[model samples]
Target: MIEWFTAVQVIVALLAGLICLVLGFIGKQPNDLTLGSIVLVELLLIAQLVVTIVAPTVGNEPSGSLAEFYIYLISALLLPVAGAFWALIERSRWSTVVLGVVGLAVAVMLYRMGQIWFVQGTP
Candidate 1:
């Protein structure tokens, strides 16, 4: 895992999380802006997944435990994908809340990725 990529993911997730929280509070119904932001965050997660795959192949294996990395990698992509789909179907404030949780989960996953990458004998 690249520190730079994980850092970017964390930053984008934080911004998206903040936006989702505000939208969840103020919106009458979930709108495109909220949906769009959620999609963008999902895209970032996909990028991270790609990097995670390529990095190990190219000799940049992180230092974290494999189990943890696998869990984080899978969850990072799955959460937002599922949340966005659910939000699309739900069409309510709950959708925003779902996105918000997705954002938060991605951020936590990034932090986990960081710990895994840097910790001794972990990856």
Candidate 2:
């Protein structure tokens, strides 16, 4: 639940989402750029998963519901994989749009995860 790492995730999601969105708008099919963005996001989420596991052991335990935090983290981890598979199967501009949507969705979910882990129910 490190704030700086969460910020980095959010920024990456936003930039990838916006770029894919623009590509889709221009009628581009799911290309390397779109797929690469998903790969990057998935890698970051995997790293975040590791951090989440280690953070508690290091005494950086979450301030809010641990169950909720895990749920968000797991869901965020799945989005990019699913999006990439969908794009590979479909191979259309809409596939690129799906990537964009997943990126944006991950960004929002990450924001909420940060809240649940650090800021929720605190004075």
Cα-lDDT of candidate 2: 0.92
Number of backbone clashes in candidate 1: 6
Cα lDDT for residue 15, candidate 2: 85
lDDT of each: 0.81, 0.92
lDDT of 2 by residue, 11-97 (tens): 999888988999998999999998999889889899999999999999999988888899999999999999999999999998999
TM-score for predicted model 1 compared with the true structure: 0.89
Across 32-96, the per-residue lDDT of candidate 1 in tens digits comes to 87778878888887877788778878998877576778787887878888888898888998789
Clash pairs (backbone) in predicted model 2: none
Q: On a 0 to 100 scale, what is the lDDT of residue 74 in model 2?
A: 95
